[model samples]
Target: MIAQTLSQLRQLKLTGMASALQTQQEQPGPYEGLSFAERLQLLVDQENQERQQRKQERLIRTAQFKLKAHAQGIDYQHPRGLQQSQMAALLQCDWIRKAQNLLLTGPCGSGKTYLACALGHQACLKEYSVRYVRLSRLILALTQAKADGSYGKLLKNLASFDLLIIDDWGLEPLKAATRNDLMEIMDDRHDQSATAILSQLPTDQWYQSIGDNTLADAILDRLMHNAHRINLKGESMRKKLNSLTQAEHLG
Candidate 1:
């Protein structure tokens, strides 16, 4: 009977329940006292938990974040102008559901990228699809796609993500073609999907960096109008880590 039950579970693709049943049978002493209803409930719970874990794994795999950052692992001890309360609120991921944008601005090594990745991680935990791409690299890829006549398809793929993280914004000046490409992306995402931009440049300088005043206005109008800005300030985290390493070596 036990073998038949296990075979039925396997045929039904309830591997989690089958595994739990096998464990219960192996350690029968503990489960012997449980009622039949209780045993069935335990199997159901195990199956549901396994399914949720598998979903989270798939979401994380699809995200492709550069940093394996998590909201719980954020360093509140670091004086990087990050507020624990603000981060906690963002962790709920309500902003993403609302299709709002996040703008993270700070100097290099100020943890903008890490924070962005952390938020992306949280989004994945909530089962939201995410994608992280460096702005310069994305622009280059789009340019190449345009040459290959796959630009529209590429944009469509990007638009499908629930949260898009564009890291290293304003690292290079935007050419006319790139600016228009950016505008198109923003247009597609406006009021539809959430976008997070990590940048070393201040918001004021972004207009000039875009090069074309007209296209800049169109792009910024979509991105900045409904965005939450987080301006990080403090010493470089990289320099601090290097100093700590040197101190440890000396000791």
Candidate 2:
């Protein structure tokens, strides 16, 4: 009777531990009654699976990119310091409420892209949608999309993300079409979602770099307003790294 009750409970699956407690729940006759150790092992395996699934879900929620961070020498332990006000503004911006924007300007390797990427990474972890694209690639895609008649669709898709990181601006001057497309993106996301931009050019030169005094000014107007600007002033990281390597070789 005891065995029957246990078997019936296992079959009915009323208890969560049915796999370990009930012999019939596991296998055919002889094998089913075989070993308690086997059942315990299976329970452990199930627990591990659940834990892994949770970890995967957490990663998905964060929407972080291993690539962008890795390339930028971004490590949690070695974050650079901005002023207290700047840090607070970046972390607790009106973007959380109304979805504004962030503009990062500095010489190369002053951590502009690193900070932009970090903010986008933060938004992703908070479960907000995100997209990170290099300015070169973004312009290329926009140009190609226009040629392919997919321009509107692309903008629509971009409009949906909670945050966008446009990295590596000022590497090259923009053409008229590219400038127009950039304005469209700024227009669409303005007051709707946040944008994080990393630019090597200063604000004053943006008009010339963007290739139109009027359009460039318009873009800046939309971007600079209600946005937090972080100006990173430091020596070139590339030159610093090269000097270090050269010194090591000599030693």
Worst 10 residues of 2 by lDDT: 70-79
TM-score of 2: 0.67
TM-score, per-candidate, Cα-based: 0.93, 0.67
Residue pairs whose backbone atoms clash in candidate 1: none
By summed lDDT, which 10 consecutive residues of candidate 1 come out lowest? 240-249
Encode model 2's per-residue lDDT on 1-251: one tens digit a residue.
74775677558643434444454454456546658887666655654565555544564454444245422344333233455556545554347457877778888767676666666555554456777888898888888998999989999988888788788887897888888889999999888888877888876777788888899888988888877777767676556556666568899
The alpha-carbon lDDT assigned to residue 173 of candidate 1 equals: 85
Runs of candidate 2 with Cα error greater than 4 angstroms are: 1-81, 92-96, 239-251
lDDT of 1 at 24: 97
The C-alpha lDDT values of all candidates are 0.91, 0.70
RMSD of each: 1.8, 8.4
lDDT for model 1, on a 0 to 1 scale?
0.91
